[model samples]
Target chain A: GESVGLHLPTLSVQEGDNSIINCAYSNSASDYFIWYKQESGKGPQFIIDIRSNMDKRQGQRVTVLLNKTVKHLSLQIAATQPGDSAVYFCAERIDTGFQKLVFGTGTRLLVSP
Target chain B: NAGVTQTPKFRILKIGQSMTLQCTQDMNHNYMYWYRQDPGMGLKLIYYSVGAGITDKGEVPNGYNVSRSTTEDFPLRLELAAPSQTSVYFCASSPRGRFQPQHFGDGTRLSIL
Candidate 1:
């Protein structure tokens, strides 16, 4: 079955430093991708998204880079902060006559102050 | 605005018990979805509804059922609860477009013993 996965289960970074999270997807038919941030005891919050036609998209201090040829996606956060410590997930939108998102296992981002 | 609201922030159920997780969105989105997340893992789609009176099964919908009687509400029902059903459930809603970002609720924590 086609699925999405993360390269690292955890990522550690110091405050004010840059952090990057990587994700790999197996479905070539997916056209849209999204990044979500989940804090403790809360739901996943939408961060940034990019479409297949566009290779990159930026919002606030976050940027999402999509590589269709490699089936890879990456999220880069600038000036990491303590509040950024949480789990990050990447999801791919599969259009099966309807919209469906397939999520990755998630990468835990730990920012040290 | 209360983007999305989920009832009973936490719940406990015994084996064979049944319960419904309620979800409602005030944003008037046309797409609603239910997903379950286990510890250290990503969310798995349980079910989704595109509009009123329209529903479809997702990746992990075996023990779950859903209905969308109105555009603002989509509830998920679990029958014959088992230990495997213990997880964090989140409800999300998006606009009519396939590229729209989803707004999520806080989520409900369920423990089945």
Candidate 2:
């Protein structure tokens, strides 16, 4: 079965510190991957995305690393802020006839001031 | 323009009731998707459409139905709602391409009694 999974259920870090969230996928055929952030009472927001062709992609304050050899993915947050606290999810797009996304059980990031 | 809009931000339904969760996007995206998020879990894809008049079932499509009659709208139908269906439903859209990030609407919180 194809599945995406996270290594941590919860992560706590001090403000201004760096945070790393890890994810793993079982489907090697997946070509695209994405990370999303969901706050309380809101929908998941797109954070960043990386295609299979790239090993690392950087955003404003976030970075996504894809390791196809181990079938693992990771999100790195630089200078974590209190407002950065939210649940992060990793999703893999499986292309069949149509594109479908498979999400992982999320990792909750808590930034403390 | 509203990136993605979902109506009925919250709803309570009795078992066996039927309702439609309306979703509309103004981004002119050709791909639309419906997902359900359970507590402490990831978003599960229910259905997706590539373009107008083309729809396909996703990983978890048993209790839900969807139609894409237009490029801007994809509605999800829940027939005979069950208690297990209590979750947050989200609508998202993306341009037709590999690694195109999805834009999501604020989810609808549905409770089944």
Candidate 3:
């Protein structure tokens, strides 16, 4: 079955440094992609999203880059902070009719102060 | 605005016990979805509702049921709970558009013994 996966299970970075997380998706039919941040004992929070038509989208200090040809997606965060320590997930909209999303295992980002 | 709210932040159930995880959104979103996340893994869709009186199953719907009687509410029911059902459940809602982002609730932590 088609699935979404992250290249790294965990990423470590120092404060004020730039951070990038990579994700790979198997479904070519997916048109929309999203990034979510989940803190300890909490739900996933919406971060940024990009559509197939657009190769990149930026929001606040975060940017989402999509490469349809490679079926790859990446999220870049600027000036990493301690509060940014959490699990990040990338999800793809698999079903357009009902807008179903398939999520990646997740990449835990640890920002050291 | 209480984007999305889930009841019973935590719960414990014995094998064969049944319970419902309640979810409601104040955003008036037309699309509601339920997902379960196992430790260290991504979320798997359990079920979703397009609108009132409309419901459908997703990737992992077995042993679980759902209903949407109104636009503001979508509850997930787990019957004959088993150890496999132990996970963190999250409810999310999105607007009418396919490209809209889904807003999530805090989540319900369930442990089945």
Each model's TM-score?
0.95, 0.93, 0.95
Which candidate, 1 or 2, has the higher TM-score? 1
Off by over 4 Å in 2: A1-8
Say which docking band candidate 2 falls in. medium
Fold similarity of candidate 2's chain A to the true chain A, as a TM-score: 0.92
lDDT of 3 by residue, B1-113 (tens): 98999999999999999999999999989999999988767788999999999999888999999999999999999989999999999999999887888889999999999
Q: All candidates' lDDT scores? A: 0.91, 0.90, 0.91
TM-score of chain A of each: 0.92, 0.92, 0.92
lDDT of candidate 2 at residue B57, scale 0 to 100: 82
In model 2, the clashing pairs are none
Q: What value does DockQ give for candidate 1?
A: 0.57
- Candidate whose DockQ is highest: 3
Better of 2 and 3 by DockQ: 3
What docking tier does model 1 reach? medium
B22-55, model 1: which lDDT tens digit per residue?
9999998999999998776778899999999999
Q: Is candidate 1 or candidate 2 better by lDDT?
A: 1
lDDT of 3 by residue, A1-113 (tens): 23334343789999999999998986999989999999999889999999999999999999999999999999999999999999888899876676888888888999999
